[model samples]
Target: MAELQDELTATAEMGELAELSSPTEEPPAPPAPPAGDALTRARALLTTHPVADGYCGLPATLRTLPWYDLELGDSSVDTDIPRLRDGGVSALLWTLRLLPGTAHAENPVTAVLEQLDLAKHVVAEYPEGLRLARSASEACDARAYGRIAVLMGPAPAAAIGDSLATLRALHTLGLRVLTLSGASWATEAGLTRFGEEVVREMNRLGVLADLTGASARTARRVLAVTKAPVILTHSGAHALNSHPDNVPDDLLVDLAAAGGVCLVPCSAERTGSALGDVADHLDHVRRVAGPESVGLCGAYDTGAVHPDGLADVSRYPYLIAELVERGWPESDLAQLTWGNVQRVLRETEFAARAAALRRPPSTARIERLDT
Candidate 1:
């Protein structure tokens, strides 16, 4: 008891002596950099890497006259394209402007053609800053030339209908990617005979298939049939939050095994309106299916609320920097940024050529589910 009391008294006396001498101590270390600033060096590293946005939405007025004429510095515009380039984004999958529904259009094929025309018009208008990339190598060329490579695509396989000829035509029209389900739809065990044929054609035509808004079952079936690596361009880990939009861990594992990448969606509705939530989704996918299996798809200009720290495309540097601060090595960050998806894109091109030579157009008829 005496020893304990003496020890306490000695600690108290020492504390008091230290406090008295504290005036001579150096000023407390300057406050640490703001969260974003801490990642400054990491952001700089992005310049040397080819950063790609797996999915990016566009305004409803995409086809309106002179929409592409908006100046780069125009903050009034929903997406600051110049800002995206400054942040080191070299390639992006820009969605095609389609009519309301697949079946409601007067001439669906013409609608598709019009969307392609808009894409070409933008590239022509901004020749120095943008170009349409039809292959992975073209994207790399755009990066070397300091231009943003725009890869035009559409959502939902339904838009192409059951026409293999349309799939081939779209590929020739500069359509390089197709989001599996354009919007929310019913879930099924797997692809219908018609859907399976669609995958076969996509694999043959060199169009990258994205299961962004697809149901879990449909994703599995597509994964099973797609000969090339697939992508879930903008999805979250369901195990973390169980949001309908989030992909479950089992599917993630399957996706990785099938050589596909799951690009973490930056939607506030799924990851919350905080940068930390975005990091959480990234970390969870990394933990569940390795960092190589994960990538990013910032759905900018989609009208979805964004995290304060990531309000626009210019803020990508902060996100990359945050991951670095959390001890993510540069190599892993490369895969998350562009390496993995680049490889997938390149391989899809090769697979397409092979399929065109040896694989015949699927003779399978459309198998109706509603029937």
Candidate 2:
């Protein structure tokens, strides 16, 4: 019995020794941090499809502060180079408008020319950060080069006076958009004969007609007359908000059917001052107009209040993050951020080519046509 017990103890000791002699196994690696957070995902999506903000009143803001440099971030304004870059903004259609009560409102054409010059000067001044894009393709190229494309235009056809030659000249000066306000015509009756001719001429010039402030009748008339797809640069869904700047459901339908884009703005006046409110406007537009017909505009630097989460250009990702939390598919968000506007620009260019082939520049003057 004593010998058997000794042999058993020896065997147990041998097993323990063998176990200790074996190589130690590595501890399992710590689990990686979660990458599915809404903000993180939103940032990832933006890296591929950066925001192509349809309307930014930065030019007007810059016009006021001639000595201000955009590179040095300004606390007074919502847009700056740093903020725009942080927001993943790839392109901006900088609106050039001489407000009715402003200093140079009398000679709108010259004032508009000065505004255009300022826009060009800024683009040239910040060659490393901004590139003046005359077309959609140039905007894309600017993105590839890691620069923001600056597209400039003056609002209201009145800025060009009553001459089609001025309109053509503006296009040559890199005016990619021209807003057709109801005030441009001599009368309030929808669009006069001259207005229709202006629309056609704009179609030929490849300038996007913006109907943001146009009356419903005028918007519809422009829609019917324009050969190219128009854009409401900084508008919202009127069904959601009762603001005059918002587009009605019927107009939304017509705009979408015409292959135009309605860029939902993040202004408190047009959309409620909350991230969710802006998202709601986006959802409403997408629901009513289809995803392909919807886009985004910060409407920054316009002296209007902004939503809580979208207070400035840098807040775009947060709004995108909110949409992400709401189960918005990345594909749809891509369209909202960039694809829709790019498509509209491409289609507008195509229409312009077709229009040029169909007819030469109209010699119709407002005097003769309206009489």
Candidate 3:
């Protein structure tokens, strides 16, 4: 655990923060706030608003999947709930995937269905602590009642198979977000025609299409066709890290122009540093594509190596403090944390509801396909 703290604190030149204690340490404490008079107010302001990790995971959800194999201990079931509550995280987009090449990879559609069932089961087991959020209003309500709103998303293009109706059915079953493809799907190129159809279906169904794992071509194609705002739920800027998973400056500008948000993640795979690196990615996205275009998608508890100060879900305040100390305005911080994501959700859901009302009653048909 001390080794993890050392890795998190090994910043480039931003000095270091106090060591973050392991989750099992006595009292299960949150990270200490950076020294300053304004930090107290920053922490207060953070708790005042409904804080949302645009993309995160709970220990229970990850533990159910053997592939993760995380040694979360008792914290997996008991302690992490309080950790999130104490950290002021009211809502999160919980990702559930059955990636290709895995044991459950036979039928992508069946895999997604089973995974969705598992997600519901986990949420049901924790009735008081968690609730499924289908719309932005539901997420805010979860915040008002002091419960964590768990919005579910399926990753990559394979999950939907070859049918558009399958996409609609998943949304009907409470899947709110969709990823057209990830980095691995990059080899399957020339998807302009089919990709456009999928994006349109997502708009009609009111699902937010996430482009985190998409190739540049796929991302650009979807952006060109999507009428509603899209979200790069967990990615970084290519200008900063040059990873294929990261979005380039051209796509970043395109994303902002189309009323989308590029949510920056704190994982080492995305950003090579900790809190300071996160701030840099956030600032770069804002600078390249305005403040409204950036947001947070820290994939907590998904088995990714988190940077130092942000080693767990309970350390969100430290990230907020780092941004505040860097002179981010309160309004910008609000947008980064929750406002932008809420706006996208509300708009997307509203459009979906409206489309459903205008459609003919007989149009709802399940197109049969062999998956």
lDDT of each: 0.76, 0.87, 0.74
Clashes of each: 1, 0, 2
> Evaluated with TM-score, which candidate comes out highest?
2
Q: Alpha carbon lDDT of residue 170, candidate 1?
A: 80
- Name the lDDT of candidate 1: 0.76
- Model 1, 1-371: lDDT tens per residue? 99999999999999998986897777668887775665676667788775788777653345543534433655544454578776678888877645465542545566667767766876777787787898889999988888888888754465566566777778888888887774223244556666777788889888888887687778988888888989887888887766777889898889889888888867898777788889899999988888778988787766678877888777788888888888888889999898988888888888888999987876554545223
Q: Summing lDDT over every window of 10 consecutive residues in candidate 3, give the lowest-scoring window.
A: 362-371
lDDT of 3 by residue, 160-218 (tens): 76566677788889988887774232334734455666667787788898887787777
Pairs of residues clashing in candidate 1: 156-182
Best by lDDT: 2
Per-residue error for 267 in candidate 1, Å, reads 1.1
Q: Candidate 3: list runs displaced more than 4 Å.
A: 1-34, 59-73, 76-79, 99-101, 182-190, 357-371
Q: Report per-prediction Cα RMSD to one decimal.
A: 9.7, 5.5, 15.1
The deviation in Å at residue 41 for candidate 1 is: 1.6
Please tell me which model should have the higher lDDT, number 1 or number 2: 2
